[model samples]
Target chain A: MAQLTLVQALNEALRHELREDPRTLVFGEDVGRLGGVFRVTDGLQEEFGERRVFDTPLAESAIVGSAIGLALAGWRPVCEIQFDGFSYPALDQVITNLAKYRGRTRGRAALPVTIRIPSGGGIGGPEHHGESPETYYAHTAGLKVVAPSGPAEGYQLLRAAIRDPDPVIFLEPKSRYWTKEEVDAAAAGRLGQARIVREGTHATLIAWGAMTARCLQAAEAAAEDGVELEVVDCRSLVPLDVDTLSASVRKTGRAVVVHEAPLTAGFGAEISARLMETIFRDLKAPVLRVTGYDIPYPAAAVEAAYLPDLDRILTAVQKVLDY
Target chain B: MPSLRPDQLKELYRLMAFTRRVDQEAVALQRQGELTAFPPLTGQEAAQVGSAYALQRQDFAFPSYREMGVAIVRGVDLVEYLRAYRGDWNGGLYDLYAHNFGPIASSVGSHALHAVGWAMGAALDGGGKAAIVYFGEGATSEGDVHEAMNFAGIFRAPVVFFVQNNQWAISVPVARQTAAPIHRKAEAYGFPGLRIDGNDVLAVHAATAEALERARAGGGPTLIEALTYRLGAHSTADDPTRYRQAAEVEPWRAQDPLLRLAAQIDDEDFTRQVVEEVEERVRDLRTRLLSAPRAEPEEMFEFVYAEPPATLAAQREELRQWHS
Candidate 1:
């Protein structure tokens, strides 16, 4: 076990995969020499050489479209989309080709490709830099979406994503890149399991990606007020761990879904609806949501107000508790 | 440099004739309501067959939606290939790995990058295999095509970009698609590009063969723009008379690719035998396609992923219960 930041732990995971799997390749814009903008892939190119780790043209569609082809040709490709907002340009390829290739070929072909996107806001970057795009991928049928809240999950989940037989949208929380934790390199974790970050009986705070950290903080604050809030870190979004979520929500009897994406049609709505459908009789209060406003992610100066912070989460938790 | 012998030339003509017959039959089937719609490859037979024929067994071909001739030359089962047009499946029901042919990509120019990427893998594997991708002049204007060509040039991927410039993207003319020649687009990507008489089987075969050889020899990618004409409507549902004049169609009809190849073969007995064979095969195909089994509703839940999530599995069970 070694103490490492999320970015460093992810780099360690990538190094292990590249060294172990000869068919694995890592490539994207600036992923070769610059080691990625966040340096998540730092020292990868030098260690693996340009053949295994390389840079691509600044075209997002080709980056993903070609990855699909490479996967068809019996290669495991782990590509990056730079940032969350820029992922929209490649949405056509992701949805049309990567997500549909297996079904289109009727299981004769499998694209074991992992698309890494440094997702979500809180760093106060420029416009189009800090946006929550996980809902788009989670809603896609053929894709497996996962976002690690901290270092340990980041290390294990990325390794698992790279090894899965299906396409995985690995959303790396950019805001949590610097958070440190001890990650065991040999630890094993499955893709579709949810982790309970905090134990409480009053209510359940369901969140993923960067918002999970905020939920944990809210749980800490609620504990001080003697209102215990259980935080469920939804590591995998597509193959959602509904059993775990239902159990947690049933035990608490109150739930508040949180995300950085806008409230309308966001993934929060899906979770809320799912909870109401299952274990509706077990609930003591109605499920509420704490999410961003239904508008374009505002400029960096006002992004904090747009994103769901600890105060907003606790407010939602209080509302559910009162209900 | 890749000239065809007399026997190979005869074989090429036979494939072209078969493609034309199947295309016509598919159109007739669409008119009779057996198919949802069919894109006729009437005049582009030589362009599709010649280029696809140049590929070796180790090579793969990526085709656009209207390349029934290419699919024929690649040995894809004709009835299975038409399943997409029949609305039986998303692409078609065929063994892609066995035929070395990709699914019919309906989205224009999107699969160009796929060919390049596949070719890059071949290069990485040190296998002397190449990939050929088919598109139309209109597809050249897509952003994916530009990026695909650029990536092929940069990586020197063993790929041949075979553009069947069939003169019409639905109602839009080739002139509206590009001001400069479509072949010249390769020059911007740092590769060689050429134009050919798409109606001439010998020229089409020779150019594609040469490009494939160069790609296999690590000479990088080449772009071939075969200047053909859409002798029929864009699809069974389209009305070409809305935009183009009858006079324009008359000239292209005279320059039909099959007619040009038939004139070159110049053997009445051989042409008759080829036509008889093609008609018999088309009849068999029609019978098989009409009797093909409908897909199961549960198939929608299957093949979405190697392991369906709990939510999808529950939904699938719900659907089964409803049916029960």
Candidate 2:
């Protein structure tokens, strides 16, 4: 095991899958020679050859739309959508076809298609660069949505997603791509299990994707104040490990849902409602949410203010603890 | 005549006549409140059957909701194919892989991308097989169709873009759908496009067979726009009298695909034999459809995913509990 960044680990996982499965294909805009804009797919085309790993035309819908067909044709296509906001152009294909194909065909077809979208803000790039579009995917019925916090989770979850028979929307946190962690390549894991990153009893800070790191930071800060916080990294959002989430919330008797997407109708709402439904009697206080404002993901300059940081998470944690 | 033998011409006549009769029966079924709705291929029989007939055993066909003739040609179970109109299933109940046909796509023009993608896969697998996608003239207006064509061109994917220009997308006319002819759109994608008389079974079959051959030979994609008229209402739910004139319908009646094929064959005994065979098959289809069992409620949750998640499982269990 070596210390590798999330992007590097993802590359390793992709390489492993490519070596293992001849039917697996990796393609997207700039994913071939350019190695992706974030360099996550660096050296893949050179290693796998253009047939297994190649570049596609700059059409998001076609990338996903063709991936669906490729999947139907018995190829496991792992496609990328360039960025989070760019996924909207392919939403029709994703929501209408990819998500419904299996149900449409009545289990006759299994689309092992993994759509990778570099998600969340923190790089302070221009508009449409750093939006969190996970909620749209999570709400979709026939899709499995997952987000990794760091290197190890990134590598393992991506591998699992590729192996999964159903379609998976793998949201890679752009902000956390450069963060390094030692990833065990042989480590085995499943898709719907949540990992408790930190153990505590004062309160549980539930989050996924980039916000999980922020929650860990908040937990660290809250510990200084003599209030130990538990942090749960919800790896898979769709087939939610409600047992893990409820167990953590039940132990703490308090919960704070966190995400970077807007507060209204976000995935946090679903988590908050689930917690309320499952562990209502075990709660010490009402579950609070720390999320981005309902407004559009603002200009890059003001993005830091829009995104939920340590201060916002800690404050929400403090409110739940105080109650 | 050069491409098709006399026997093959007789077979084409039989298939077109079969499709025309089945289509008429389906419309009647809808009128009798058996089927929820059906988009009749009343005028586009030759275009659907001829192109579908040209597909080799290894080749696949992606069809829109209206291509029941394609389904018939592809040898899909007629009872199973009618399940979608019966509102008994999402798509039809046919085995897609076995028949080498995809599910009926109600979302117009979306399956074009799937066809191209499948063709790309076939090409990548280094096979001689090709994929054919059927849509109407109006489907050209969709962005996915344009993207499918563009991708097919760039990748040299083995696909046939078969557009049955049946003149109407519901109430919208061909003129409203595009400025130029539908086949000319292929020129921009760096491929040859053919415009043929959709009512002529022999012409439709030859064009599709040639296009399929080119595709299988790695000649990239071809677009064939078969010009015809929507001789009836778009669907059982639609009314042609509201949008079109009777005068316009009168001329297309003379150019009916089945009538044209029958005139070409010109054998009264042959036509009677084809009609008898079609009637027997339709009778069997009606019996099977009427007798088909209603799907279990729990089955609704089964096919959504290969491994249904815990939440979906729980919901399924809850449905069972409610029933119990």
Candidate of highest lDDT: 2
Off by over 4 Å in 1: none
For residues B247-287, could you state the per-residue lDDT of candidate 1 as single tens digits? Answer: 98899898888888888889999999998998999999999
**What are the Cα lDDT values of the candidates?**
0.92, 0.93
Per-residue lDDT of model 2, residues A1-323, tens digit only? 98999999999999999999999999999999999999988999999999989999999999999999999999999999999989999999999999999988988988999999999998988999989999999888999999999999999999999999999999999999999999999996589999999999899999999999999998888888899899999999988999999999999999999999999999989999999999999999999999999998899989999999888888888798779
lDDT (C-alpha) at residue A173 in model 2: 97
**Model 2 alpha-carbon miss at residue B277, Å:** 2.2
Candidate 2 has which clashing residue pairs, if any? none
lDDT of candidate 2 vs native? 0.93
Calculate DockQ per candidate and list them. Answer: 0.84, 0.86
Q: Of the candidates shown, which would achieve the greatest DockQ relative to the real structure? A: 2
Q: Compared with the real two-chain complex, what DockQ does model 2 have?
A: 0.86
Error of 1 at B30 (Å): 1.1
RMSD of 1: 1.0
